[model samples]
Target: MLKSTMNQNKVQTLKGFRDFLPEAMAVRNYVKNLLIDTFETFGFEPIETPTLEYSSVLMGKYGDEADKLVYSFTDNGDRQIGMRYDLTVPTAKVLAMYSQTIPMPFKRYQIQPVWRAENTQKGRYREVLQCDIDTFGTNSPIADAEILAVINTVLQKLNFKTFTILINSRIVLNNILKACKITEDKNSILQSLDKFSKIGQDGVTKELIGKNIPKAKITVLFKYIKQAQPDEYLQNVINQLKILGVSKNNYQFDPTIVRGLDYYTGPIFETVVTKPK
Candidate 1:
């Protein structure tokens, strides 16, 4: 009997992973319920996908760092597979695979765990839950507006304040990078520039210089990002893109944001919470 008990205790979770107990699960369920209710009220439907996906499907979708972090392995059938890294990529694959079957402009809300073979930090874990709401097959601003409104409503109900929602477009960033003569290989440089808020402008400038980006161009880029309003920034970018023969509407320029994700093709946004520590 003692040996059996010892054997049970010896089994443990891998490092950087965890198992939620009942009390924690109850709280999690409650939060998830609230999020589900909010998303459903906004006409977002629930969908689920497999936890395992073909390794090729998830690779290169979330940038180089994320690609390196994917939990890939060979199954008994000698097929390479990976644990789902984020709800978005799997959802995208589902859309492409069932393009003919699913309804157009599919609005989906998914809550699932994603695995990452990376270091954990505060408010981040190797395996964590992501709540995503997305609309496919529509390029309407109304769709974008609805997503923003729904997210704002959910956060308001949660009593979170002192935060702002920053929105931008990847096209706009790409144009800016082009203006600075920075190649696409400078994704890490751009990512560091995006961190200006968290690490300060001086820190970002130093990091960019370290990355071998020109100091004068970095100064110009930083000044551009600090524009006070979206309208002013849009005007400048619109003028620049016009000279380059790119339409203003196509970029969907919004000055309020710099999204962290590399895969976001159109409008991108981030929520900044300023609750007291």
Candidate 2:
């Protein structure tokens, strides 16, 4: 009955969770070390934040999908709390609470685990670690460029290839969304549509229609997004804005991008792998 006993004693992992053994842990540590070294070389200091934060602190920040995915519950003290969803929000809170002590134009790198209740799939996990380095107090484009450059250099060092960096500003997207006649209440609809790259056009279309967005508008929005290269796309967007007489320096029409979260007030970027995954 040894086999029966072994079967009976087998422990099941929770859904959307995983267990990494020693070799996996070693690989993770190695990668983390490389990231740390790169960030330090660029003069970013390290910072740590707690895993659990009051739910109110993170509320109304990361948009609907992110809000839905956050691991939140009432604690023993009967307080609503959540596991950290991303480094950026926590960083913002830290700055708000400890601004007096921290240096201006603070640059910090945080590597930590974030929890989300998303569907589990390859390269996507409900719980995953993020390697984040952010500079607050300075809205300089130079800081943006530096972050991009550091990411590129580090990824190249790791032998990653055939990747494209997509960058844009949320201000630009807000203008476009208004131009498209999509309501603010439907921002999630746009964000969901942006997932077309990962989930395919048909899947995204289904999601949008499911949200009751009109089929014709969705069709036009997809076509408009697909028409031009990065620079050309920005120019086209500028032309459209000029026609509408809306003047804004921040809303650049960056064609290289597909989608990003709502909380990114300024520059937002993503690196997409062009080669097979």
Candidate 3:
């Protein structure tokens, strides 16, 4: 009876969380190792931070939408804490704490699991592993170009044949907002614009209109953005990529590639598989 009861009471993983059996774990480990090898080849050192942090450390860092997704609670000691959302913010705090000790232009890689309170979707989860490589303390365009090179190298090593890296700058989008005379909150408009790829032009227009942005302004914004070209700084980054030998076929300028994250200041990149879904 006890054995039958135990079998009946077997526990399963929570929604949006998963358990990996040996076969799945093996593949995960192999891919992680490959990523580490590629990052190290580009001179990036690994670093790690705690999975839990004071709520104060994370709040007000990733914007309002992201803040809502943070898993925060009061602990037994009554100290508010939150799970790690991404590696970038913690890495920023680390840089601030160790600024005097760490050298300039610090390049580091971190691969860790992050937690978010996201609604379950096909592939979206409350907990997901993120691999990040970041360079700090340098404003040089070469560093940006090197990131593109590393991306190309890793994709080629992974044997992905037909993928395109969409590149853009938030600066360009912000300038567009100004040129369009958009008096509404820019983040709101940009958030909708960021959905262009997922929802397409008509969908984004509907979203913007729902936000009460004038239709005329939306039209002007669309027309102006279509005519917008890469500015001098972005062109310089592209030139550096050519000098670094990253394939020109692998990337292109995309004004519509505005990332959803609120922290992106300069260039941003997203890779899409063209040949496969």
Candidate 4:
């Protein structure tokens, strides 16, 4: 009995990891296939990248807060390396490397596992599968609109009854902060603001105040954020979405929808399901 118990302990998976048995894997694979089909239908070809990248390549991309969650180590080669944090960075590297060969406006989808050193939570994990579709070589809001349409199609196809795709632009966010005379600590402010959904306005105020942002500036920040409207770029994206036949009910402009990722420059979006709640 003692030997059996020891063996079980040795074989157990590490914390924040999971082993999907056949029963679970069946469902997982089903969803993966569905995503692949949806992606291909939208002219997105499949691509894969390495699970490990040089430490230098991974650093300084995501903002300070998210950078801390990256899993990195010095390998036996004495070379510093990092596990994939998310699919976007690696895909960007791919585009740069093959820029000579790939045509403009390239669309690619990636489905793979990524690792991060996050505190274990109910629905969050250190190792999680990521499914992403990215369009490179385009500076058009129409491209952004296509992404929104794709999100709506994917979720609706999966039988999601009620969900909203929240969209925001860092341009508008930056403009608001600029109007507030905030420049030096913009990243910090955006990181805190990204938590608006989880933490209420009061919580965000507390966080900003803790960061030594002047109380007056905080007041101005909130005021500007409330008064801010989507710029012409975002307005064009919305108009294009309607042209693409994306239901207006599925997506809306949300000022508080600032994504936590620092690398994001233009439009950022997130989805929330409301039916099961």
lDDT of every model, 2 decimals = 0.75, 0.73, 0.90, 0.89
Residue 205 of model 2: what lDDT?
84
Per lDDT, the best of the predicted structures is: 3
Q: Write the per-residue lDDT of candidate 1 for residues 100-153, one digit (tens) a residue.
A: 999988999999988999887776678889899998898656676567666667
Q: Return the TM-score for each candidate structure.
A: 0.85, 0.78, 0.96, 0.94
Per-residue alpha-carbon lDDT of candidate 2 for residues 1-277, written as tens digits (9 for 90 to 100):
8878878989577877889999999999889999999999988999989999999988789877679888999999999999999898999999999999998899899999989888888878888898899888874556666676677667766776556556665655555556577763556765785676678878988888888888887786666656533343334433544343333431333432535567765556777666546
Clashing residue pairs found in predicted model 3: none
Better of 2 and 4 by lDDT: 4
lDDT for model 3 comes to 0.90
Task: State the lDDT at 124 in candidate 3.
Answer: 95
> After best superposition, candidate 4 residue 224: deviation in angstroms?
1.6
Model 4 misplacement above 4 A? 1-10
lDDT over C-alpha atoms for residue 118 of model 4: 91
Cα lDDT, model 4, residue 199: 99
Per-residue alpha-carbon lDDT of model 4 for 59-173, expressed as tens digits? 8999777888999999999999999999999998998899999998999999999998999989888999999888888889888888888899989888999999988899999
Q: Which candidate ranks first by TM-score, i.e. highest?
A: 3
Residue pairs that clash (backbone atoms under 3 angstroms), model 4: none
